[model samples]
Target chain A: MTSALETADNPQDMKRIVIEPLTRVEGHGKVTLLQGSNRSIQQARLHITEFRGFEKFIQGRPYWELPVLVQRLCGICPVSHHLAAAKATDMIVGASELTPTAEKIRRLMHFGQTLQSHALHFFHLCSPDLLFGFDDDIRHRNIVGIIEDSPEIARQGVLLRKYGQEVIRITSGKRIHGTGAIPGGINKSLTQKEIRYLQGDIGQMIAWSQGALELLKKVFFEHYNYHLGFGSIESNMMSMIRADGAFELYHGGLRARDRNGESIFDHNDYRNYDQYIRESVKDWSYMKFPFISALGQENGWYRVGPLARVNNCDFFSTPLAEEARKEFIAIGDGKPVQSTLGYHWARLIELLHCAEAIAELLGDRDLVGKELRNMGNLQSSGTGVIEAPRGTLFHHYEIDELGIVTKASLIVSTTNNNQAMNESIRKVANQYLDGHRLTEALLNQVEVAIRAYDPCLSCATHAIGKMPMELNLCDDDGELIDRLEKRADGRISRTI
Target chain B: MSTDKTFRMDGKAIPFEAGETVMDAALRAGEYIPHLCHNPNFPPHGSCRVCVVDVNGKHMCSCTLEAAEHMEVDNSSDAIIDKRRTLLQMLFVEGNHTCPACEKSGDCQLQAVAYHTRMLSPHFTHFFPKRSIDPSHPDMMFYYNRCILCGLCVRVSRDVDKKSVFAISGRGIDSRLVFNSPSGKLGDSDFSATDEAAKVCPVGAILPKHVGYETPIGQRLYDNKPISVVGDTIAKNHSEKPVVIGGPHE
Candidate 1:
């Protein structure tokens, strides 16, 4: 798999391959492949084109509004931004602890978000590629296709997503852009009626989530070599862990581990993340590259989200998910799993964990407590961090004495995985494109690499829309030679 | 006799008093005609033009146009709604109206009006005009970014509060709310936390200090229901509630 291509004999000829508007992702992105003389792959990079400037525009606004304001960042994962901003604003008001009811409700809301986002990604976005094969007709490779081929599974995916959305609506007051969360605490608590409404569907949601996991495991075992080796690259892992070193999603301290399953850092406060993480800007892409501070830039890049979280944690607090984690680890021979495609497996496990956790929270009595808010004095600076479905999200703010935000910065999940994503694209380009004539199918393999990360370029850039990606290939002289564009309507056209 | 004196608004006969404007009549009848600058408590200042309605054959500000009997008013027509959306888009672009980050979001008339009109995305180019915030006042803040230049504060301060503390200066795109005080700050002006003008702002331009987010979001005035059902009267009533700090249950 690591062998260099022998197709290129002449050292002077050059060609370019371009895939414009990559399909089935969350926002706008393009992959460019530069082929050197004789079909030898020279370079490949993913470029995020959209920009919203949330960090810059958020300045001068009141710190109290950040939680609701930042929800406009990404329509798909607004809850993550809402909770992260709320947590940051909680720090701004100097509230170290919230009422028990507020804490539990927030956790429940976060878990709901994870379930919905993972379901949408696994079923709506990536499943078509897995179910129909990567090179299947692009027309029949979507949720609509799934509905035609397997109606029961497709319906289950939709219903499971609806369950998560219902949980959000009950807690946050709306499905798309709710405003229940506020600084220091949430505005309201769950009532008996709302609790009962959510409880009615939990059993069905859990069964469907478990079935989704089983289906993924079966697929992985069937295509074992492709599942283990496709777009696989070695990198460090990062996630938030509870103080007791259990799996945590909503609130916890930072942890980083090396590829050899060795701990680099254990459970450090999120407020002090600057000491361990630093973001470096690149001229090519609008997204910032974040890496570990201690390791230097070259080896500092680490992966996050489900794959990282599953690999970095010692055990999950939930029972079934913990058992699944043990089997997942066994697949890696008691070592960190480096396969990029393992992200699908890891995501299914998390879906199971979120389902179990939501059931557990629903049983807790503190979810409906009346002490819903903690009115605290406003402080000048605060930081909030949470595990967004995609990865760890950070929201930091500096307020004036009058409570207006003076400065703001956010590091979204996709931004943290920038280096690893680019590396995976390059690896795939070298492995598949070298010594072979470029085809639309071969270029799609490159996109399959990115789909594994489930990158939300919209959240990373704080922009909008259903992502349509384009891949472009150019010669050494910078002329576009081959172009593949995936239109938003799910049609693929190749121009050479 | 009442039916004889009624004027048609979107094909529904809305009865009106002798001297009331179309907006006043609509409000009293519990019908919503979207408006930004016209408040029933104050004389209509037709500057915002968000309440423009087609009367007979011509478009006019519903707040200033008297409700003539048998008049055909196109309040909910597609053409009228599209024009209102354009006007809303202009308001969004001309000033920095960040609804998501504003204190008056759910309760805000501009935001509610936009929602009522089904204005999905701000289609126009964003001007991103630079504006200043006046936090010098001890009891209130003047966030100039959210100002829509409706002059409600000016009218309320002059006619109701008897302070004449606010006025509009400049012209066209440069127009902005100015303080009557020499220092041009709310602190130097005669404005108080209790002034009627403080609660008259339709947007978040003027806000009381230290009392943000007192009401939880879901129970807030516009969270559960659309703005049209609440009508203008209820929105004004909810916006008039005094800002209370450190209250367990206001």
Candidate 2:
């Protein structure tokens, strides 16, 4: 594949840029460009490598076990996998018609999972770059950096996240692959004591969340250049819209919208997902791309995640969340604010909103003592859709007469966002690079773009097997001018 | 049996506490309920809705209902037996409950309860959601397929163990057990081999995979001996720990 692009050194060669292992992201992948002699990216590739057959291993198991079974996907968002799996099971049992109490608790838990996972992404995983310096050594760039640099704020973030996990534990039987949520209904009943514990922490969590919001405002306003340096792109966005036409996570219809906030699709039309989205396999990467099905592969550009969600939804149910979305869009709604930089701002807003919602749900006495598992015995197919910390997640399953899972399908958030990230990076790399050397700053910019999605490779690949990643740069003549030698370890070798 | 109307407790005919759970009174009177979910530490969540007993009117969950006076509590009532059978049916339907393939099929509490109630067939439909076996923890195996979702593991971890390692997630029929950490597998979870969550699972779901197949059924739960009689000695001797009468800790 590398031997295809050998070419003469001309103006076109001068315009090309290459980024490898897009930095600061959850998994590994790279992007490359071929200039059209007019300094335009004539050929672009979003290359990914690493594969494991999670779907294959889950085939023989009983359908009811999917919640715990699918949890091995990603360590960062095991709750997302759990939720998706539960939804899949529900589909097998046809349990989508949940009672109001069941719905509320489900939403609360979903919001909690989203909140904690996003908090971990921002404060623990991605924030250090924006706060300290993007080029800081990999060793000094993690949650500990926040602790060492800003102890008070880091502690607040950690505690707030812990509170979310606590809620997950209290509601479900466990924090991660909870057994509380079942095919027919929940396993455990909620109690007044649990409600009290959740209520008591509302004030503390709210304060901490507000502190994060204030910090985001300071960074955005104070460090204009830093914000500008992050990548952006123009693409379509998708998310869940509640029955009342507000932003929702737990159980709702999916909505796809363009940059102008026009609803292109909505109203429980998931069976047509393949029509709107087309997944394609690339040799270089195991993760599949979901392009706009109507426009066809490369032309169809859609994104999923915090940035995409905010762009797609008209309003959030919670007041603070609505306010945050407005503020976020105000920055650059002009052309779908494609820069991955916006992911940070959007994520903080979600974290803030989730905390507030948690407090509200816990304070409601009705929610506290309502029957947890009213519909525990039944057999029907059901569907579950929620916005994971990364983006929108869909779980669909079909069961046999015995209520065993006959088929299972999942549209993970990260996979949906793959194409968008690829397109977004190409745009950013094209706009900024001027046939310059592969500077660390430019490389960091590309990395931040991928990090914005907070993709979880662990969740994407469940089977245990080695998948190799190779990087090759070619010139116009289809000759491999530079090729990274394959080494026993994933590290790129200089021998080639 | 029909003439008695109620069983004698310590030779005094106390009207079974109207809805006063037989298990509660028995425990209150320094007697044991011999049930796993009936944790004296906390109110029973009733995931393992065993401990069924007969009130004057009908059979009910002993943990949830209050005992009433003069209630002819027939713990051995045919109605009580039928209710227990249904409860086990619910348990079996919720997960991949393959008793024959289960490691805990022998010494399993779910199996013991099933035997006590004479559950010949799992009448309810099976929601055999695909399960993941967590052999990740070196010393134990977590067969999520056989989990009854009793919340005992969750309760033990949070209420008694203080680790808060286990939890349940999703809602309605989609619910299943989860771990605290990101990787939902037991390997990545905060649970240790000795964590209370691992220890409290009553079915083959959270079995010590190594020990299940080593024993047989008759010698497994009843062995023709009533649980009340065998349970007393086992409770004092720590039945899980191997011990001959002349052996250490035996």
Candidate 3:
């Protein structure tokens, strides 16, 4: 838009610059930078503008519908919501323990989701900045740019997305909003034909995943210092871990590791999460800042997602991922990886883990077994937590006697990383922004930091092309000094 | 003449009995007319207007219009298809027919008919008219949101079950399926889950309470094939055997 990083000298002494509706992320958001007379950023905030009252709206719906209906929150990761809600409803329906077939099929679906989502975030959203310099041509700097510069990467990404979707389609029914998982168990099993279909491309997917991880490692090492220091922040890490403290995405006890890689709490049941975690809201942002309750607001803010999961877990279950994790975690030197860009590397490792997990589940005969569902004693209330691609997702529901959800509290993955994303953006702004100028490249760097968390800001409120990028530079008197508008088609307009 | 005894629907000859509606004649010929209110086992009542076909370039409800000899019916014209799609869109927006989680999702006549007509999206802004669920019935559950006011339950209950247990109240946009019971709940009425009326609902409005999703989603009657091929699978959902979870459930 502005030659990627063309200087926007504020000779007129603009007080603050605001960037609205970020490009290339799942949804739109705004960032405001307040600069002082010195060549430094005084204040920076990544404001979440949209309010998705999903928890409130979900109340009064039939609890069974929660799995299918709540997935509408985000187009990218609907399966997480589907399975999370199904898990909660499983308790309500008294299906305390799912049949082996049902649980395995669900696990297979989660792996597919993780693979596709991580692939999309890397190749489509973050690759241009990583592969091509962030300061390169403004126009050719997205998925289109990737296609022109590296078509193989683009094809790999698209096919990976399709392969993952096919896994979902077979397991859930439709790729996006499949009605596969129900209260007690899944609706159906993977037929032999379906299993064969998935097994066909999984090897390719795994190889591609390894290749991509290697590529990312090479890219990181080439710009090793800059990549490590860019937007880096030290924070607590959190995720769901297996009882044995291995990496677990589907179901596990709660775990949070401090910056020193020591446990804040481990192996605790997540049902009492409210006692450990608390959310506080700021007036400037629509998102709530969740912190570990005992640590209090100032020190309790923690990050969740791939980087957090990899850091907090003891080891990876799959051999390839375990090897990769060891190599990757060696970078931290027995400490949690606090570098923001390290998120990309962590995500690729998980993608490889998913591919391997999918291959293992394909051979399991339980997937095709007939014992699909089992019911236990009924319960009125239940909670479900799972490791979504973005982070840890929580869904809790209390249904009335008539099986209607009377209360619901949903904490989506992106929401869990809200504070971490804000912290990352603040670090980027401090490092890149000069009080005298605000450039497109500098602004993009801010987004690059937030992209690490892969926040789905549109999870609750989604608007497509309607949300074009707009920036307003306002003075101390709250009067506009200069306005820069970037339309959906990449057209930029500036008026003073 | 043969033309005097038979009519052509999209150029297929359909012989009709006296007093038979166009929908009945086509259905008897084993052809699907993509309807919501018309069932072969019951009398045709064309209040939903989803089966409006072109006859001599005039739009008419096939479920209500009497079949005439030598009549030319256009059920597959672009104009007819567009009109059906528009009517379906209206029906979709007019009521809260959430197909994804509706117990009648894959099996629902409205959803199947929409699919058969290729109604990709509900084009109009939804009138998410708030409606309450009638879960008082021990054996049956009624989700009014999934109902399109198809009148199948009402008519079947009246004509087949002889209970006259259901009726539609209000006008136009305000119309909703109402129970005959004074408390306005299905539990207060004498409508049993085994009644033909319960089996005749084309949507999720009438369902066996505890036995929902007894048939998994993919292997469902309408899952593998379109409703046009499989036809009415909901008819076979009625159970003569007792349900283990039967009895009034809170």
Which candidate has the highest DockQ of all?
1
Model 3 lDDT tens row, A49-166: 6666778887877777788888888778889998898888888888878999999999999898888888887877777778887776667767778888899998998899889998
**How well does each candidate superpose onto the true structure, as a TM-score?**
0.86, 0.62, 0.90
- Quantify all predictions' global Cα lDDT against the true fold: 0.81, 0.62, 0.80
DockQ value of candidate 1: 0.37
Q: Rank the candidates by DockQ, best first.
A: 1, 3, 2
What's the lDDT of the predicted structure labeled candidate 1?
0.81
Error of 1 at A167 (Å): 1.3
Per-residue C-alpha lDDT of model 3 across residues B1-250, encoded as one tens digit per residue? 1234678999899988877789878876878888887766556678878789999889999988999997999988878889989999998887787666576777777888888888999999988888878888877888877787888788767766778899999997878888999898889999898887877778787887655454656777778899877876543443343222211110
User: Model 3 chain A, poorest ten-residue lDDT window?
Assistant: A458-467
DockQ of 2: 0.03
Which candidate has the top score in TM-score? 3
Per-residue lDDT tens digits for candidate 2, residues B211-242, read 31223223455456655444422232233543
What's model 2's interface RMSD, roughly to a tenth of an angstrom?
13.3
Q: Candidate 1: where is the Cα deviation over 4 Å?
A: A1-14, A23-27, A455-494, B1-36, B42-101, B111-132, B209-218, B222-229, B233-250
Alpha-carbon error at B208 in model 1, in Å?
Answer: 3.3
